[model samples]
Target: MKRSLEFFPVQLFAVIMGLSGLTIAFAKAWHFLNINYFEAIYKVLLLLDTILFFVVFMTYIFKWIKYPEAVKKEFNHPVKSSFAAAISISFLLISIAYYDYAPSVSIIFWWVGAPLHLFFTYKVMKFWIEHKFEVGHINPAWFIPIVGNVLIPVVGVDAQPEMVNIFFYAIGIFFWLVLFTIVIYRMIFHNPLGKRLLPTFFILIAPPAVGFISYFRITFGLIDTDSLFLYFIALFIFVLLLTMFRQFIKLQFFISWWAYTFPMAALTIATILMDSAYDTNLTYYGALFLLAVTTLLVAYVTYKTFIAINNHKICIPEEE
Candidate 1:
């Protein structure tokens, strides 16, 4: 009972930090603030997120080390705990590297953290396959790494030319596709009911949208053109918007609203990248418009969420 209670705060902190980091990244990427001021604010937020990463990391390590056998027994799975640890440490090292301090420590931690993340990601997928976990449920384990993958590049860590970085990105794309495929299959064929349905769909589509955006920027030189990529991205954004409208009418708006912010932000970035590839004015303007609109929408939802949480109205149904 004591151990179970302890897990709640760590998990809550991670989720909150993940959401905050993504919000900051979108603001920075969209040039919402003046250059000098934005850089200062961005750095501060990154630092706070980095500190939270360590707190969550150390908490997990303590839990695992203290009750290794119990952890293995309870979940009947070691991979989730292992992946959570890898993701936390990776965030810490990447944060240090981005700030350009502590080179020796950063390099060592980077080397250790990256491969462990890749290995643990694979292990988690294997566990999912072995156990046949349901698609509708959000696996709390993947939460940190998913956010880290998107935010790390924006943090300015010059990951190019590093084989480990390349491999990590590649494997990340693969796992994202696999998980996304499973969710879509479940939605269409199995038709999971109740609250899980919509949240599951939002989560399914988000990673690919994010993965495509990340790869487009990171692998620009490797790919011939980004135009082809943007077309599919725009399609996904439309689908997601339509889905969200359906949910809103049903009066099921909850934290799932935050899901739209990341992908819409990605679509905006992808449009900019596409313009660089093709140099079309329409694409450039369209991307800018989308970015502005999405930012406003996200700001509104964030306000609503703040109000809901403050008034103690943010209720997520308990998982069975």
Candidate 2:
């Protein structure tokens, strides 16, 4: 029993954030479908998300208290520590969903989450500068901390001060461009991502997708040409990444595949939001197509997760 009590790594919180976001996206898609049962699934998934937050949050808290070295290991790891940002993003996503029905609870979480998120971002940036890591060190995962800040405004408009949301949004967009340039440069001049990290390339799609949604929400539903530009940029990179599907399939499965889920879901949600805001028929069809694709992909990940667990492929100490 004590052996079983060992905490799972905090990095695994990425799975919770990804699943919660996907659940919310599914709810939104169902709404677009005009499914009478949409509200039922939406609420059920929101409850599921809340339960997950508590479970994972407590699990990691146990690690923080019992296994200080584990936390140190992650924090010092150049690649792994940034994933800690997932915890903050998880809170933000849940707070966004929570605001739909419980404004007070949502506001409390947002106030707490936004500062923690920026602090985490600051630490990661500090680490990067101190280490003086070069362009060759860049990866899709680098975006996790920065991109998450921009995501704040998704719920910040209702939960945080306007200027606070704008500040983070500006930081998010600026670093997104800076990091994108470096990541693209590294990919062109260096060797390809190893199998374990290749799935993270899908992360390339997330910034612009989430950016589109955050921009729309923060601008109070403005759908200008700049908005269209953002959406298309996401759409283009999403297609660009799809070309690697076969390469990804040929590689063995790893937990990093979870990296693929949220971006797909984000793009799906962006499609639905674009359609609703612009009332464009083409975007409506596009939203349906993206939703179908996201559903199928998530189902596959779920099937593989159970199989991986039975095989004892997960739930083990990870290599640095």
Which numbered prediction scores highest in lDDT against the true structure?
A: 2
What do the candidate models score in CA lDDT, each in turn?
0.48, 0.80
Ten residues in sequence with the least summed lDDT for candidate 2: 1-10
Estimate, for each residue in 175-294, the C-alpha lDDT of model 2 and write its tens digit: 999989988988999987778888889888889888888899899978788778878898998888778779988878777888888898888888888877766778788887887777
In model 1, what lDDT does residue 107 have? 55
lDDT of 1 by residue, 132-169 (tens): 55554444234334333443332223534655455555
List CA RMSD, all candidates.
Answer: 5.8, 2.3
Query: What stretches of model 1 exceed 4 Å from their correct place?
Result: 1-113, 133-162, 217-223, 249-258, 276-281, 297-317
Backbone clashes in model 2? 0
Off by over 4 Å in 2: 1-7, 30-33, 134-136
Instruction: Give, for candidate 1, the lowest lDDT window spanning 10 residues.
Output: 1-10
TM-score of each: 0.63, 0.93
Model 2 pairs in collision: none
